[model samples]
Target: MILNQSVIVDIKDIIDKAKDKAIRLVDHQRTIMYWHIGKRIFEEEQEGKDRADYGNYLTKFIAEQLEPEYGSGFSKRQVELIRQFYRTFPIANTVYSQLSWSQYKLLIRLDNQDKRDFYVAETIKNNWTVRQLERQIHSNLWERLLMSNERESVLAIARNEKHMSDAKEIIKDPIYLEFLGLHREASYYEKDMEQAIITHLHDFLLELGNGFAFIARQKRLHIEGDEFFIDLVFYNRLLRCFVIVEIKTTKLTHQDIGQLQMYVNYYDRYEKKDFENPTIGILLCAEKNNAVVKISLPENNKTIIASEYKLYLPTEQQLIAEMKKEIEKHDYEMELPTS
Candidate 1:
């Protein structure tokens, strides 16, 4: 006999809850077991502190005793990592039930405490899966974001406690689009870039930073007898404002800035609610002239920003060089006298 629609909905809810509870239960038990293993290893090390390679030998012996019965999960390397995990997070009270063993394994590998703390907090706040966490770590998301702000700001973002009073908080300069698989030497059309971004919208939104939700793509506007098409549009819940993004494959120009300014003005006047903050506009191009941007906007401008986008991920050295240039430009802009 077929069930009614209401019965089917109830059955789905039951299945979802059961699946979630199973995952939580398994993760909690696994985490506690690993922590206990770590504690045991630590106590042994303390008792035989004089032995130089005692810890290694002890872990190997423990693995040999357990692996034959319990399998590879109790291997020497795994046990060592568990020992490090326990050392790093000494207090059992600090462990949360939501994190799985996979997350803890990655957290244990992070050498810097502050960076480790940031990743832990961000992983929980964002509800990132192991795969997402790995990608963020590989991309050096923390360092890339920290490159734009002071140390305190990084903590605020990781904690999801940031109060964004300006557009700068959400705007990342030299945005990385390495996942697009586009080559730096090859030129592409604006629409091509737009299509690629849409195809990888999930990664794009993550790269765009937190609180961004897609609104429209190539949004059209009809005013009087004229027509206009905006390349991309997004809404940032944290900013409580509409964000307009325009893509350019070539170097930025004063005219490009002017066009973006018009779009921002339109969004603020037409799209945004009375209680919302002012709209923000971003010009994403292959190259941007700071001089042109400075000259194009009004003196008190805070709503429009122009930033470059990289087609590929930069090396550590390349990231440093790029960040240095941006910092120098910001300093130069600051030192200029007011008109």
Candidate 2:
């Protein structure tokens, strides 16, 4: 018998969906089994709670008995982690079915409850792969965001507890582009960096944050017979605005900020719809002077932002230094006398 092309396509789709469902079912069952094992271990430890090492003893004992029969996954370290997983999420129903064992393993390692919660919400909302979640953690995404926002506010947005009111909620400063394969010692042109971003557009978008869609590259604009080209243009659905990114391979100058301000102004006046929010302009540069940037923009300016781009993720020490520098700057600004 012969089948129509549409029928064959539909059949293939059904088979694919069935396979996905079966995999998910198996994963869910495995997660439940681990939770049950953890629960039993916790209950057994309760009897000897008075002893300081009883919990460790119980887990090690359980692992020794189970590993030989069930394989390496039930080893001592694995058993201890599973028990900690149960401690982290006591209620079995709170365990996210959408996440896999590998993803949970990463989440369970986070010491901060708020940080862990933020990643869990982001993973579920974004459908992030285990590798993606791992990258975000290693990159210090939570700490980077915390630099600009309050802890509760950041957590609220991640948890979908509040609507995002500002672009900073999603825009990150000192964005990492190690995936671009650019060496710190190597000199690259603006076009070269722009091309690299285009080549790894998927990773770029993930780094850009949620709700951003690429609109154009080398977006041309004509004003009174003069022509200008924007290095990149993107639209953010959540912000309901156009995002213009100007690439600078060196330290930013006031002139660069002025040029970006013009692009933002032009887009706001000509391209943006009546119902849309004001266009936002970002200067993605290798370095920027905070004083120069502040003086370049108007006091009330919220549409233009200067964000530094790093070729690699900052180490823990470097991030701490940056945080301290930001805190000192904020304190200095707060001390300035009002007019």
Candidate 3:
């Protein structure tokens, strides 16, 4: 009674298709179920306008009743989450399938409507997983936008565009490298950190922001029999240029700036296409002497940059203090009389 070989193959294909369709159907159904639950909770809470204390007790009681009947999916905490979800996104049509409940929770916590909209748009545009969304949230992507000259422009692009145009557009200055899990005070060599970044390249790229693809590590360049090795090389499709990153474990110096400048020059002359933009060089260090950086680079310098990297996320107060210092410096410089 066994089927022939061709019949078996056909049957297997049909089964596979059926299973795929079933899984998709199940996902759709689950999404609908959650939306409905959220809606019901919202309506009930509105109806019991005077019963402020009753809401909590009612959710717990409902959870107790539903858990046994509907399995563990209806836990009290989850019910509360569902209620919050409804309150957050009243418009069911805006509930994207790509986002999970956890991501929604984070979005709801964002007080600024513009900031929340930017994250939601980016989340959908990038097809970011919940974990990626969480990482970006933790990295203070919204706050970083506030530092940009074109804050509104960037938000508009993020909201309306399908993909970013360049890595530079998305990359934050002084990128937070806290995910590296290195100690701030401990002595570490530049090569050691470079190696670590290469080893954990995926996570590093994620933290580097969007549109970056690793080209090589310790990419060798030959010029008239002299050999030079670039620490790390990447191509940013959005920027349409090669990005050269040099790591320094200590404070930045004029020498670091000069070295990066040379790398940018080399890439532009030998590596970059005629239509491509000039190669961009980044000098990443533990600390930077801003005066030294400004003096070392040409007044019209656009290809090279020096930025600090942190081994740990700064505390809220620390971030605020740093921001305040930057603002004060700007104000003081502005108020000073010109020579």
Candidate 4:
């Protein structure tokens, strides 16, 4: 007897899910096995005073025996990594079951415990793939977050210890768009960049931070018989607000901020519900003067943000310089007297 099409489809889905679960289980077991191996090596070293020689000898002997039975997985380098993994996470419970051995390998290399903890929390929260986690690490995402927020606040958000109330906590400056596949040297229009962003909206959302959902593009608004078009629009679930983005390919001017401010005001007044937070306006420009941005908006303005965008990934030195500039700006703001 022939089965119904729906039944066949359901069976296929079940089989696929089962296979995925099995793969995950095997991966978790492999990670646990490596941790146990590392623990045994550590235990062996406890009896010897010279840990250096003891570790070397232990790994070498293990590799000599295990390589004959297993394969390259039991090589001396692999054994050393396993030992380091155990050393990094001494407690078995700290080894997250959701993460694969490859992800753990990357986490073990980080010397800073806070940074490692942040990544662990984010990896679990976002369900990020190993490649995505590696990319975030390479992009210096943690350092970028620290540029605008305190270390503890950033970690708190990542760990779900605190709710995200401000966009500044998640929004990054000099937003990286290398995944858009646009050449830095090539001259492009704002529309072109917007199109590129929509084309790779998934990666853009990853770069935009968590809880962002794309809404509309070139959203039309008629105010007093005048037509205005918002370049891009988004809603941030965490912030509970509508996000208006205006793309400017050239250096930002005061007029750009005024236009964006108008859009934000329009959204807050007309588009937003009473329960929703104030709409946020973001000027995504190629270059922006911080002083100009500050002077254009009110001192207490929290709805408008001027963020620079880069077509390429920034170097470590560049990110450091950016962080220094942000700190200096923050200090300057702090020194100003309140009215």
* Alpha carbon lDDT of each predicted model: 0.86, 0.91, 0.80, 0.92
Q: Is candidate 2 or candidate 4 better by lDDT?
A: 4
Q: Highest lDDT among the candidates is held by which one? A: 4
Residue 321 displacement in candidate 3 (angstroms): 2.8
Higher-ranked by TM-score: 3 or 4: 4
Candidates, ranked, TM-score: 2, 4, 1, 3
Pairs with backbone N, CA or C atoms under 3 Å apart (clashes), candidate 1: none
| Residue pairs in candidate 3 whose N, alpha carbon or C atoms collide under 3 angstroms | 166-238
Model 2: worst 10 consecutive residues (lDDT sum): 162-171
Alpha-carbon lDDT of model 3: 0.80
* Model 4 TM-score on a 0 to 1 scale: 0.94
Write model 4 residue lDDT over 272-309, tens digit each, in one string.
Answer: 99999999999999999888998999999898999988
Per-residue alpha-carbon lDDT of model 2 for 268-314, expressed as tens digits?
A: 99999999999999999999998899998889878888999999988
The regions of model 4 sitting more than 4 angstroms off are 1-4, 327-339
Which of candidates 1 and 4 reaches a greater TM-score? Answer: 4
**Candidate 2 residue pairs that clash:** none
Best by TM-score: 2
- State the displacement of the C-alpha of residue 92, model 4, in Å, after optimal TM-score superposition: 1.2
Scored by Cα lDDT, where does model 1 land?
0.86
